[model samples]
Target: MPPCNSTSHAVGGNTWELAVVWGVLYSDSAVVWGVLYSDSAVVWGVLYSDSAVVWGVLYSDSAVVWGVLYSDSAVVWGVLYSDSAI
Candidate 1:
């Protein structure tokens, strides 16, 4: 990982990954939700609470999903299974 610009951060958790590219702008409250990997490039963005999350340019090596939801909201995604999932 490279140096983060300002308060931006890159975090990984729960068998998922979240990476912020170098020079990406971030605020104190900005947080990386998570990332799912697949063969296609896919990125997901989710907003918790009423605060808005501003994400800069994001690139994925596989399929990515972007979602924004509120408290008590449920989201379901049907992704096609593939051999290259990681």
Candidate 2:
């Protein structure tokens, strides 16, 4: 077994929040697994859509950082998008 190194980061918004963690590898196991890590991104919030209006369009641009795995480890994957309507 190898020693584990850990790291973490976090971010938040009016409608969402995200967090991530990573573990580094060491010792003999290093050659087998390379690096060790884990992370997660969560989004939770409330918003209101205008139901009383007709033909209303809401636009938004959004992005989030999430967890990825490589050799039994976790990494960060970020995504971006635009022209979102409610």
Candidate 3:
């Protein structure tokens, strides 16, 4: 794993989970996988479900998602789209 500029690691599920600042977190895992960004300052988590072999749930501070997303399946159901971010 490449060294992150600034981050805080929160271990869970046998993975090296990290909270990064102004950086990207990605992976090349298979099945039952996803990517997310949690702005620790705001206590918000954006869970993006996809298997594009590419980036997913793209956001630029907009409500309309602009990308080729396959599907969003949340194992932990009812992920709230907080109005503060949209």
Candidate 4:
């Protein structure tokens, strides 16, 4: 694996991978959440969350399934979103 920008960990009992960014992006204060991988080639992806996850740019080599659930909540996705796979 390449050097991460910050801390890293595994999810779903070593199923899905995750990384915790401890640095800021650009001059704007932000918590970078990166899904780092050696290769962007993937055919499957699944995300499960009880709250809400607002994603901006999603870089992937395969299809992605963003699953979310919440009560009395609002959600919206724009065309600028990148949800594609190889």
Best by TM-score: 3
Between candidates 3 and 4, the one scoring higher on TM-score is: 3
Predicted candidate 2 versus true structure: per-residue lDDT over 1-86, tens digit per residue? 43434444343634433343334433343222223233343332222222321111222224433232222123332333333341
The parts of candidate 4 lying over 4 Å away from their true place are 1-28, 43-53, 56-59, 62-74, 78-86
Give the higher-lDDT candidate: 1 or 4.
4
Tell me which residue pairs clash in candidate 1.
40-62, 40-63, 41-62, 42-64, 43-64, 44-65, 44-66, 45-66
For 10-72, candidate 4 gives per-residue lDDT tens digits of: 556675444432222221234324332333243222222333454443344455533333222
Clash counts for all predictions: 8, 2, 0, 4
How should the candidates be ordered by lDDT, best one leading?
3, 4, 1, 2
- Residue-level lDDT of model 1, residues 13-81, one tens digit each, is 334343433322233555434332222234333222324433222333455432333333333323333
| Winner on TM-score (1 vs 3) | 3
- The worst-scoring run of ten residues by lDDT in candidate 1 lies at 35-44
List pairs with backbone clashes in candidate 2. 23-36, 23-37
Task: Please list the residue runs of candidate 3 whose C-alpha ends up more than 4 Å from where it truly belongs after superposition.
Answer: 1-30, 40-55, 60-64, 71-86
